[model samples]
Target: MYCEITYQTTGERWGIFPRDIGEFQARMSIPDSINSGDSHDTIVKKSVKIEIMSCSFTPDEKNKRHREALEGLVDRLVKAGWEQMTERGAEWYNIKFHKEMQK
Candidate 1:
């Protein structure tokens, strides 16, 4: 599966795999490839995308992970920028309410 991570601030985007979809993971970590910042606090996160192929996991598990990943991104984005939005394929989930961001 393929996914995209769009930045609401710089409008910069990138593509990542399943493990790269969440926080504290290797790809999005402070010392991972594609990292644009030196510190975690200064790192800018615009959005994250994940692809799930098979039905090995339950819906609840999938939802939980997705939410956790999103929340982590929001936390990072709060310090990086105020305006951010995420679009999971065709569905859009606004994290501005949880963390005061422009959109």
Candidate 2:
């Protein structure tokens, strides 16, 4: 399973997180992966889509359970001001954000 983050405004991709960040409350909350670490900075407010792909193949018990977990994660994140991207064909968001974060 995978979870991807993107900036909705510019269609810029943030980063793609695997099941490591997909587990329920693993980092205490899914959005913590995107947090600035400075509480005073505040959330970007502009919406972001945290897309989860539980299956790139035919469904199976493992994938089904994975999908369920992703769905729950998405729901919790959405309530925290993020949104979901339902456009299956949406292009990848900008890669620079991911690159910069690596530095």
Candidate 3:
């Protein structure tokens, strides 16, 4: 099984590939540095999409289940204020607010 996790942030769209649903879930559950209270930012808001592909399931029922799981995770993250950021946006944010972000 292959899972593609897409994160659409303020100005960036990032894609993460997880080997399976378990890995995807695990990654989603882990908090980033900003969310862990190590950074000044309160929340990182991001829109998420998960795409799953499985060869075993003929009808691909597993994909639906995976999508549901991903949706749940995304909802949780959004509620927590995890905003998405594009690469250029991130760079600009970093450069524009490097001093604040560094703290």
Candidate 4:
């Protein structure tokens, strides 16, 4: 059996901190048994795409410093293993950041 998994964030309130985010949703389409003799190689081959939609934000000089500080904090978190997804093909991983004010 073939399957796909998707993860998304909803009702998100983007800010300088990670805790300011909202709920996350993940959908999985995979077999229950690993002994089914099927391979998940295709899932790894298709490449994963992440999308953030319907977002708006603007930063001024004051907020710019805050954003930069947030970036450094996120970098430390990634090094600490906060990452949820990793690529099988690459030795390195990917992370994304956004500058937005959530209401």
Candidate 5:
């Protein structure tokens, strides 16, 4: 099975393997830093889409079950204000405001 996880922040894209979902979440956990405390940051919003390809699984499973799970995870992140970047064909979001805490 192959999966392309697209993030739409800074237009950067990342390729994700089915088994590497943990790694993907970890990578996204990194916080972004900005200089100038006087500067007020503007929020960026983006739409998300998860594209998947599985040889063994039926399309219904991929689109319904697996995709739902993936979107659910993403929804949790997005609610925290993660926006996607468009880079290459993949999508990525820039999330760097929250201080590092235990997830």
Candidate 6:
């Protein structure tokens, strides 16, 4: 198992967080890694490609900022233990990341 973002904020906690602003999300803290028997951080995050939950992309500054912020947030999440996952080698690319799959 990889590191889990057990670290939380004051208002509320979730397995997920709001992906609106990068700085806002940055204010939050992730759980500190635990030491393994070897006296080192025992956990790591999986390398997965995750994208924002937006329905569409706009060619504007705000959209650009949001996208960049989201990317940064993903990196932070990975570092903090919110590891990424893939089934058919597809990257996670939406807010409803865990939706019903087609049979």
Report the lDDT of model 2 for residue 70. 42
Please write out the lDDT profile of model 6 over residues 8-67, one tens digit for every residue: 122322235432211212222233447333332332222222233322221122546445
Q: On a 0 to 1 TM-score scale, where does candidate 5 land against the true structure?
A: 0.31
lDDT of 6: 0.32
Name the regions of candidate 6 deviating beyond 4 angstroms.
Answer: 1-62, 87-103
Q: Name the runs in model 4 displaced over 4 angstroms.
A: 1-62, 84-103
Q: Give the TM-scores of the predictions, in the order they appear.
A: 0.31, 0.28, 0.30, 0.22, 0.31, 0.27
lDDT of 1 at 94: 34
lDDT of the candidates, in the order given: 0.36, 0.33, 0.32, 0.31, 0.34, 0.32
1-103 per-residue lDDT for model 3 (tens digits):
1112333212222356322222222122223556574323332322243333332211132456545654565565545444433322221112111111222
Give the CA lDDT, 0 to 100, for residue 41 in model 6.
36
Tens-digit per-residue lDDT, 1-103, candidate 1: 1122322222222445222222222113233346656434233344354333223221123476556656666566556534443433332333332223243
Model 2: how far residue 91 lies from native, Å: 12
Model 4 pairs in collision: none
Off by over 4 Å in 5: 1-26, 29-61, 88-103
lDDT of 6 at 45: 22
Candidate 4, which ten residues in sequence have the lowest lDDT sum? 89-98
Better structure of 5 and 6 per lDDT: 5
Please provide, for model 2 over 1-103, each residue's C-alpha lDDT reduced to its tens digit, 9 standing for 90 to 100: 1134322222223346321212322111123445646233222222222333433312222555545544555555566544454542242321111111223
> Which residue pairs in candidate 2 collide?
12-93, 12-94, 13-93, 13-94
Q: What tens-digit string does per-residue lDDT give for candidate 5 at 1-103?
A: 1112333222223456332111113132222346434333332322333333323221233345445644564576557654433432312222232323445
Show model 2 residue runs off by greater than 4 Å: 1-62, 87-103
